[model samples]
Target: MDSADANIATELETRLSIIDTIERDDPSRRELSGADLSLFIGVSVVIVLFGILVLAL
Candidate 1:
């Protein structure tokens, strides 16, 4: 009912709208999924094992 509360509500709505717009429009939000993480972990493990083998020889 108060002007202060109304101002806060308006500001919040605006910020939320901006966040929605950004999430809807931004491409950087595109991300690798679980399969990518699994492949990365597998590759890292292989590299570490190869390094260990090289060091042991």
Candidate 2:
């Protein structure tokens, strides 16, 4: 039973490592670009300002 459990754990780790490597290599999985970051920040600032305005009124 212990050996079986160990084998399962090892297999799981191996599969997870393969998945991680594939995901890292995938071109579609990209980090935020400069335009994306700017848009996000602009939207966030607008939302915050709107919230503050609502609270004031």
Candidate 3:
């Protein structure tokens, strides 16, 4: 019973660590600063405008 408990604890710890790593690495998990958010929006607008211009031509 002790061995089985140890094995379960180890497995749970491993899984939790992996999940923590994945969450840390995930881009969407991050909060965007105001400057970063502004830059992203600006770039998106520019790209959309460029696409429209190209389509018009």
Provide the overall lDDT of each model, using Cα atoms, as 2-decimal numbers. Answer: 0.89, 0.90, 0.90
Candidates by TM-score, descending order: 1, 2, 3
The TM-scores of all predictions, comma-separated, are 0.52, 0.49, 0.46
Top candidate when judged by TM-score against the true structure: 1
Q: Local error of candidate 1 at 27, Å?
A: 3.3
| CA displacement after TM-score superposition, residue 34 of candidate 1 (Å) | 1.2
Candidate 1: segments with Cα more than 4 A from true spot: 1-16
lDDT by residue for model 3 (1-57), tens? 699999999999998897688777677667788999999999999999999999999
Please give, for residues 13-36, the per-residue lDDT of candidate 1 as tens digits: 998898788776577666788998
What RMSD, rounded to one decimal, does every model reach? 4.3, 3.4, 6.4
Q: Stretches of candidate 2 above 4 Å error? A: 1-27
Candidate 3 segments exceeding 4 Å error: 1-30
Model 2 gets an lDDT of 0.90
Q: Report backbone clashes per prediction.
A: 0, 0, 0
